[model samples]
Target: MSTLGQRFSRWMQSRTLTGLTPGPHDITIRKDLRVPMDDGVDLLADLITPIGETDPRLPTIVIRGPYGRRGPVAGEARALAREGFPVLFQSCRGTWGSGGVFTPQVDEQRDGLATHRWVREQPWFTGSVATFGPSYMGYTQWAVAADPELAPDALCLLVTMPDFGAITWDNGAFALRNALGWTQMMDRMIRRDMLPLGLAMIRPDPKLGRAFGVLPLSDGDTAATGRAVHWYQDWVGHERLTDEYWTQQSHTASVPSVTAPVNMITGWYDIFLPWQLRNHAQLAAAGRAPRLTIGAWGHTSRGMGGVAVGEAVAFLKEQFAGVPSGRTALVRAYRTGEEEWHDLPAWPPPGVAAEAWNLHADGRLSTEPTAGGVTAYVYDPADPTPAVGGPSLLPNSGPVDNAAHESRADVTVFRGEVLTEPVTVAGEPVARIQFRSSQPSADVFVRICDVHPDGRSMTVCDGIRRVVSDDGFDEVTVSLWPTFHRFDAGHRISVQVSSGAHPRYARNPGSGSPAFDAVTLHRAEQEISHDEFRPSFLDLPVWAG
Candidate 1:
């Protein structure tokens, strides 16, 4: 084992089980089992079995991931094992205690199929299996499900989206600023040494190292250190949105071939919300049994405490109980002061209607139709509007606060009159815009919020559109992620339109140059239209919920 893995194992042994407490019945834990792949690479796995002398074979849940297989999914595996399901937590071919160099999702497809095949041949195999996890783990489940020979009985995907190009590398852009930090952390593991790399790269303080269990980067010539640098450079070199490189790497192209029943779980505040919705839509449209559940939480919130573990357990039970009926059971829960879970036959709800709110000349949003007039705003890239609230990388709870950001002069705030009745928007919020820019390119950011009577405004849904691809007088439709928000009586609906939402999304330099080295900024004269010919308006999915 690598030094870091050895240390982590010792720590787990000490913390997970103390002196002689009886372990759970119907579950036996075994670590460091080798499973050979088709490519002759032996992958390491930790198996959790439901002990039964007569029926050693039990329904299985396979969680194949790049993150330490023994780490993130440990809690879920233990919980599932206790529920009478054998959970196999396997490290990806080249991650953690596994043998090989980590190369992200490229190896996952073959390794996942091999792992499933190996699991079926085991003495404890029950001929029934399901794949589940979040993010990369979730993507692996989909990839394995796409394999014709290894189609699992069910797939429970959490917070993973379809199309790497659209979401993961949106138009060939990395969403998370912590990508570098994550790469560095993984590099340390690959080199078999846990050098306090992320902390050193971010803050470079030795004192902070103690808190994070990180050792100084100078401590050892860890393989992870070198891997991190290489990964960062590789990511930087690829700049085109639709290059042959990205086309071959994308896994969504295989979605049409997947036959396993899919259960997608996402969060409203997740950075990949839009992509998750698209995945659900595609799967459902392809005549597959697909279900979707979205909550008002971040990437790690559902596992931590925001949502109840029982909810996920119930979902799994439902999927494994019977064959999917080619029907979608859509549910959306919002953390609106308290948790509210609502069920619908379809996304956006069948009875729900689209309400168009137009931007008036006097900075007012209303249902009234306007004449041939336009609302204009000056976009200055030097002092762009700072990002506040929305689905960002920062570790926090509840909805994000964008009130302070609204005060900026550069941010154009358009507000509709307070609603006399409560209104709920439950689906994808779209902004149909007809605008002309003075420069060759510009970025348009739209934020939807519910303004309370007390003057507090909480963000609901937001979207961004890079106008560089658009012609001067072309109309564009920007679709914001779906949201569930209750606009109380006397509370108004507002849209904060601006040029940029920095950091959350890399600032569009407006130079019509490459994403990496393009630093030149151009001023633009933007004109927003709301009329019959160029009927630009915000389409809010008004739901009864």
Candidate 2:
């Protein structure tokens, strides 16, 4: 280690890790741990090991992430280390402490494998290892496992997309706004020292702290904004769902190659629920022992302040201890009302049944077949349906309830009668629509919401369709992302149809041109047909609670 590294390590050990009983110690915070790729370019990493546990050969947990390794994960690393595992937290090449230019998931596969190899060679590492983390950190774990030679024994991924292209960039036609925010945050990290940049962005302004509220301070540095700008442009440039751009970021294509046992943790309201479900299904189909736990809360639902972190720790304990297959435990903890943890045999529970609710002309949703007519509404890009609630990116500084937006003229609301009994929606909800557009092509947005007796419309799930190359009049199947929610008795289920969920999803110009650059607005007359030739309905998965 360099002199600077040694000095920094000593300072952290003496000051930062002093009082906490189960804290990190003998912290050798080195910045130049070399992870060499096949092409000879080396990635850098920062290695921090716990004190007092001097086992020269111990099982290791490799955290290869895009964010700086020496940042927030330190506490979690210490806790895992206390449980007798050596933790290797490495920044991805060209990221924080790493030595390459940050290009998101494109270089992760190579860098991840290299980091795993480097970790194994460390004198303190035993042959066995695991990979884990949340979001981008979680993605690196999957990328590392994709490498044939570097596959770990176990993997724990939380709230991460199975494929960046499908989930993050353009989910069908809707662009993820949270992804744009994340790219901006990462852009700042890429241009400056990790600690200072993080502090500046998150620190409350001394004078206007309360007035500015929780918005991260922005100095308007373009270099600090490069990641967001590039990501937004790249996503917009690729209009087709099956285009090469999307293909390049898809991990779904490589699922057959991963050999590690997987544990996936996700929230029902998470923006990446579709990707999570797809990943789980693909892994199970590939004969991998994949475990999934879906919670009812949004992104930041785990850890201390949200729900119980003990559940996650217990799951990891069982996996690391070589628990038998059937004996392994599965836990799903929700945040609302009861806030209790529920144990289950498998996800979707096996008892969930598909139920269809047809959209009727008179602003009604019903299970019985109905004669359908087209409901028309004009979608103006200047004032799209504003995003409220549902799964969104953090720091989530927006309103949690979306009931107010239901009254918008551009948004069409269709409600079902009050439920006589409780119905639990436990899987993906799909919207099948047969419609004709006045223009060559247009996009449609669908939102599934739970209406309380007092008239509060809480959005449960949503889907978006970009009709870029539609044949004049056609029936399209829009797969709303999967979700788990219980509709109580007397509560009504509702569907909100609109053209856009502004800022959450980029507004569709309805101009029939390129999805990204066509700013021309055209009036589209949409017809939802429900006859034999044009049957339309929402396919909901109902569970017997």
Candidate 3:
């Protein structure tokens, strides 16, 4: 087993791995591992192991997901198996070859437990097991970890969340585009399973564009996917986090029961970055120091120019042997602008200072606060501000230059002077604004950017908030997800204020009614104020070192 120190030393010495190399041992594949569940339904899996060994059992790594057992997972299973680590690629119920209906987010806990139990009973099991995968597959690890009897020895999770709401709803606004896209993907999986010959490709949804514009958000699922996704309908119908439906499906409900070492992998632009942070915090609070790795990429690509498998493999090796990870930091984040990775002994590190930049009349952001200034913008849902990109899982995700969008009159832009010195930030930025709107309800979308000397606005991180209006000036606070970035000298800090990140978040409708049933669209006149009474400011987390 390799400790964290030993692994980091090796990683620092030679960081030139293209893809994981398989071990010298010839491997054999078993296409059917029928894992019986409590309900008597068998979940199907493909098992990969060393060809000739049968007496000395090997460690197991189970990747149970709704994704098919043979498609995306076969290569991964082969590679891990080649390295002497046997892998079980299991399919979630009703999709691929698994039994029972496929209701997303439900049945994962029990199904995961059953599969793990079956693995331990097999002769090839070394009595040590770990769970791995991204998205819902990652959830399977946590689900089983919650069960003391079935919990894996370790967990290697990637770009996934412990709860669905964090992906579909953030700060009170519905995540329209992500929810629709994901539902469509799952719907296609089921149809393809039934008609493999004809449904070669998930036929494009003709109602896609108009579907997003549907009056009732709840009914938009069938319009977009051309089929009924019951879980999605349930998602849009129950908008409250307080709903019993969500509470029962939430994976965090099992956090206290998870005692295994966990390696949490996520990207800066990953849709569930915020939720991953929440998971890290909850684990720490439970007295578990899980390892974390954040990079500068989106949901699909772990990192554009970097690979994480080496570190992940090392982490798993340590866990499987019941060996300590050794002295180390909790966070290992790749700073975006700097294009470098740094280790923080603790998240937000120690001795971090909070610097405030006040918004002023000239669209200037500085330490000097100006008096009696108001900036206004018109928010039209039909012509709502589109998502420019920061954190998202939709078709158009990752970082896109926002200069063109910032040039629009509908966006209120505030910028600071070129930096005379460099500034490093390792946590979420906070925006406190005194706001007023013509309507009784509104949505506020905010972004923090790095204004290059050449005038290009590169987004660092962004956030959105849905406000139930008081019809007057009211203070609102929004927090961007935690980030690791540094603005070099001569770079300017910028803040953008707008009404909506349409399709990214469902348009607020401005009617103060149910978002789904909103028929009439109204334009809103919004104002951002800064003065003695209402001094609006953007809080930056500056690291001393």
User: Each prediction's TM-score against the native?
Assistant: 0.83, 0.84, 0.90
Residues 145-242, model 1: lDDT tens digits: 77777878877788775444455344433442334345555666676565574455445434322212212222211223432254444454465546
lDDT to native, each model: 0.66, 0.65, 0.77
Question: How well is each residue in 1-545 modelled by candidate 3, as lDDT tens digits?
Answer: 13564344234323333454444445667887788999999888988775544323346889988878765445555556655688888999987878999988788888888788888889878778877777788877777787767788888888788788756768888988778867776787777744532242345445665777776787788787766688888888777877888888887767766888888888888888877887888888888968988877687662321244555566766655534545277788888788998888766678788998888878999987567778888999878788777666543356677899998889989998889998888788889888988887898888988888888898888888888787678888988877788899999989998999877788877877876567788899999888766788888899877
Tens-place lDDT digits, model 2, residues 1-545: 46685456445533443333333334444556777776777776655555565444445777777766555455555455554566777777677665657777878777777677777787877678877677787777777667677788778777786577776444455544565456655766777645645564566323222211111112112223422355555665675658877677667778767887777777777767788778777776787747777666466543321112233344455666644435344435342322445666666667888898988778889888878567777776645556665566544421255577877777878899999987778778889877666666666778888888988787678888866535444766788867667788999999987777766766555666665446556666666666644666789988775
Clash-forming residue pairs, model 2: 25-51, 94-100
Candidate 3: C-alpha lDDT: 0.77
- TM-score of candidate 3 against the unseen true structure: 0.90
**What overall lDDT, based on C-alpha atoms, would model 2 receive against the true structure?**
0.65
Q: Which candidate number has the best TM-score? A: 3
Please give the lDDT score at residue 174 for candidate 2.
Answer: 51
Steric clash pairs (candidate 1): 26-51, 187-224, 188-224
Better of 1 and 2 by TM-score: 2
RMSD of each: 6.5, 5.8, 5.4
Worst ten-residue run, lDDT, model 3? 9-18
